[model samples]
Target chain A: MPPLVLHHLSVNYQDLRALRNINLTIHPGQLVGIFGPNGAGKSTLIKAMLGLIPRVTGRVTWGEADLSAHLERIAYLPQRSQIDWHFPATAWDVVMMGRVKPTGWLRPFAASSRRLAQAALERVGMAELAHRPIGALSGGQQQRVFLARALAQEAEIFCFDEPLVGVDQATTGIIFKVFRDLAAAGKMVLVINHDLGESITNFDQLILLNQELIAAGPRQWVLSPEHMRRAYGGEVGFWGHVA
Target chain B: MLPEMGPIHWLLDPLQYDFMLRSLAVAVMVGIICAVVGSYLMVQRLALLGDAISHSVLPGLALAFWLGGNIFLGAFIAGVLSTVLIAWIHRQSSIKEDAAMGIVFSAFFALGITLITVIQKENKIDLNHFLFGNILGVTVADVRDTAIIAALVLGVVVLIYKELLFYSFDPMGARASGLPVGLLNSGLMVLIALTVVASMKVVGVILVLSLLITPGATAYLLVPRLHQVMILGCGIGVFASLSGLYLSYYFNLPSGAAIVLVVSALFSLAFLFSPSQGVISRYRRRP
Candidate 1:
């Protein structure tokens, strides 16, 4: 697969510059993490790249085409908080949503789609609770269900925003294992992560940001004290001790 | 006279009148379509948008009558325009959506009331009929128009069920996964406009929000899935319409008010007694 590339991406919220002049190249078979202090445009970067939100200036290309033109190749898991847990859908119902674009318009889900959704639920250990309402699931279980949805999309690129927040260790393990499996299969996996704990070790590369690209390289290089201090300001001391 | 009639005759007596038959047919169709479309409004927490659109359609109705055009078409255009205006105001300015809706809908409503009041001085129209609905005055053409709108709304909804489900549940995920979020949103607005316009004669603009929200909310309390909510809501809406018409016939109550009252009662029952989410059930489950 051709690398996913961003050229001078920037985003503004009215007068406030949320992200500025971000450039990165993400290769296939890499599990990448984006780290930043709160309000550092971590989520904004992912959203801008995917064209979910407007970008002030940038070009995002996957292979030879604009990324916006080939969005079907992407599987995106938004922050869990962004979803309405009270929506009246079962775990199985949400997983089947992944097949909607692939199934094309005006056609019901075929038997093959149903099998894929079922397999995805089973992969997340949620098959037994397939019929349960999503609102009734625990936080970790809800996150797992969304993960199952992304897996069912069968896309070449995966983007997850804060999938680890408010989730259990078991859920975290399952998530990392799935991310690794996707990477091993030669798919690009990018995750926006809040924690810099031991979980940070799971990423093959890190992109640290504070309204701009502070550093982007292998995990250890991007986590260096100087780069951490630059991106996080005075909070670096807390992160340094943790690191 | 009451002692001589059987239960079946009492039920069948209303069917003898052609006007009653037309009203019943239109009411049933309105019930089904409103519940289906209203499920989306309730789930997305855009119940106020429904109220906004319904109220805003009045100006179109007045203008269409003044121009001798089809009032349903006019109302649909006005409803859609109000939503677009609300979105535009919200996006172009820092005004939040709820405030924008409030401003635009009330402005349009005021314009409608003004136009109707001025037009009624010369014409034989009654503003109260439009406000409260005159379902008994529905003509054959009105029934036919409502049927077509109902079919179109239900057909599009059925075809795009999964896409709508995904979009409504997680808009960012759906948009990122290649769905045309804007087109889907516009299509929903159009469907809602059609549903509101089709329902106007049965419930009036003032009370159509009740038909659009109450039945679906009642079913939402009882069911755990969107399709289930819609299906059950349809049943609830139709039952309320049928029973309310009967009560209106027997007690000489206004048809629209009677239907709204019945649907509200059903929602109250669900609120108090639904098995999973009801007040009583949750209270009973407590230790």
Candidate 2:
């Protein structure tokens, strides 16, 4: 059975169509890279998968269970600059947030939760800076901190949005290594990335999107010149301006 | 007989009066509730939320007085209703949050003043008192009301702590996590309303913003953790409440304003000397 399935999905913002006729299934342990230019509705597609957009008409199922009920089992890392970096919070504190479940609130983070958070930080090579404030970190370090937070979730399926944006080469390599490790462990890793040339060589599967699914299959089969032209050619200026 | 002098004499003498005891209880409850709720508001960057609610509550107070109903209940209802409206309009429009808050606060405040002038032209309630509380005027009922509201606000904050923090830090992520982002947002507004209503008697509707913003802001400047910020803010709030009340009794001033002023002073000091986020600290940290 597919790890995640989306059927007859359509996302609209007022009169504009963000996503149209999206149907796809992702299997477990697959490293799927969603590549598209600006306004390609890549983010919207992911948002729909996570049930973030209520205006969409579709069914998204995870295994046999309702996707809504199994949200805690999915770890999501948003765009790097989406949050207020100046927020007064420690790195460990931010990581501890991942250990929270939908139902537990009475007792604070337990010893096991703290150990998990610490291990996640250690995995991201952020153990030394666990006590540092989130605002004090550099761009790449912040991304790593979030990765650590997601790591603490220990979810079966991991979804990351623009995790490599503005990150340094070293940190980017570390993040991809983490992704590779997750995929190797039979966990699903989905990333919305713009770095096409590298993504072609790195990702095992490519989901080409331009407001709809242009192609979805093995990397070489889906990353053909035709797909790139369709996804990026017409929107070169638009993407450049936004980027 | 004149009140005794000396530190213990000054502090304990105020508690000797029944009204002072009531005022102290109300202020303590209000301080605790505001600090707890204000931490969330500060994190959400809805720093001006208190300002909006306090100003908007005037119309409700006027209407309640006109109807001969409970003034606190009217203010509570009015504060919650107007805040919901502001949040809804904000979500539905392209107008920025600051502009939206400004528009709602002015309209409601003007409507309140107009109603008060027209309805009670002969024996009007003192608007100044509402703006600045007379702590010595608090009664047993006010203390009871403050406790109940404080308890409710604290309960909700503790129950929905993670959900609220998740949304405040990462709204898109929270939405993606299948959390009810809209409901959580409204829940925060309701908490803010309850806090404002509870704090109104002690801090008054006018300077209530101080209790909501000052201690939290001061703590933010000094602390690096959310939990620490909350604990420090509550401590500062209680300290300001007690000290301001004692000072007011001695100086013949409004206790609420005095408390706010003291908290503001601490905020200034934190702004100047706090280790990491403070003005001096930031400069010190700079290479």
Candidate 3:
């Protein structure tokens, strides 16, 4: 698979610059985590890269072509808070949404798509509750359902924004395991993470940010004291396992 | 005293008149399309936008009447224009969407009322008919126009059901998945405008919001899926329209107000007695 590259990406919210010139290349088979403090544009970075939001200046490329033109190969899970849990849809319905574009416009989902959705639900241990309304699920279960949806997409690139927030330990374990499995299968995985705990160790690479690209490299290099100080604006303490 | 008529006779009595037949046809078609399109508005928390568009169509109606153009086409154009103006205002400034909708819709409604009052002097037009609906005045041409709009709206909805479902549930995710979200949003607006314009002669601009939102909301209280909500809402809307027309015929009530009242009554029943999400059910389950 071709690597994903971002060239001089920038985003602005009115007069405020949310993200500065960001340039990075993400290779396949890597589980990448984006780390930043509150308001650090971590979510903005993923959104801009995928063209979910307007980019002031940037180009995202998957191989030689513009990434926007090939969005079918991407599976993106937005922050849970951004979703309307009260929407009148069951878990099965949401998971089926992943198959909509692939099923082609004006065509209904095939039996194969149903099988994929069922398998994805089973993989997330949510098969028993597939018919439950999404709003009725617990936070962890809801996150897992969304993960199942992403899994059903069968995409080459996966981008999840804060998938671990407010989730239970079982969900966290399942998510990291899935991330690892995707990387092992040579799929590109990018996650926006808020916790600076031992969970940071699960990532193969780290992109530290504070309105700009502070550092982008292996976990150890990105977590260096100088980079952490520069990114967090102070000397910060994190899980020793990260170092 | 004349011989008492049976229930079937009472029901079939109104069908003998050409006007009642046309009115009923228009009402039933309007009811089905409104409920289907209104499900989107209900789910997206854009009920106010429905009200906005309904009210905004008035100016277009008056302008079309003045220009001797197709009134439905004018109403559709005006409804769409109001939505665009609302979006533009909210996006260009810090004003929130609800506030923007209120400002634009009211301004357009005022302009419409003013234009209609001025035009009523020369033509045999009644502003009250537009405001409260004159379903009895529906012609065969009106019935035909409504049928075409209903078919067009339902066809597009069926054709793009999954895309619309995904986009409504998660716009950012849909866009990230390579769906043209902007176009989908605009398409939804167009569908809503068409629904609103078609519904005008049956419910009028003032009460159209009730048809657009109440039935969907009533179904939402009983169903867990969007499609089920739409289906149930359609049933509820058609029943209300039919029964409301009957009530109007028997009791000499205004057609549009009677329909709105019937729909609201159905919503109240669902709110109070629905099995899963009703107030009474929740209260009963609490102990």
lDDT of 3 by residue, B15-79 (tens): 99888889899889989999999999999999999999999999999999999998999999999
Reference contact recovery of candidate 3? 0.91
| TM-score of each model, in listed order | 0.98, 0.91, 0.98
- Residue-level lDDT of model 1, residues B193-261, one tens digit each, is 999998888778898899999999999999999999999999999999888777777777778899999
Instruction: For model 2 chain A, give the 10-residue run with minimal summed lDDT.
Output: A234-243
Give one digit per residue, the lDDT tens place, for model 2 in B1-287: 44657877766777778888888888887777788788877887787877998888888988988889987888878888888778778889987778889899888989888877877676667776677788766878778888888888888887777777777888876665566788888888888888887877677888888898788888988888776787899999888887787677778788778999999998899888887657887888889
Comparing 2 with 3 on DockQ, the higher-scoring candidate is: 3
Interface RMSD of each: 0.6, 1.9, 0.5
Better of 1 and 3 by lDDT: 3
**Which residue pairs collide, candidate 3?**
none
Task: List residue ranges in candidate 2 displaced over 4 A.
Answer: A64-66, A102-107, A234-243, B1-5, B122-124, B281-287
Predicted structure 2: lDDT: 0.81
DockQ each: 0.92, 0.57, 0.92
Model 3, docking class = high
The DockQ for candidate 2, computed on C-alphas, is: 0.57
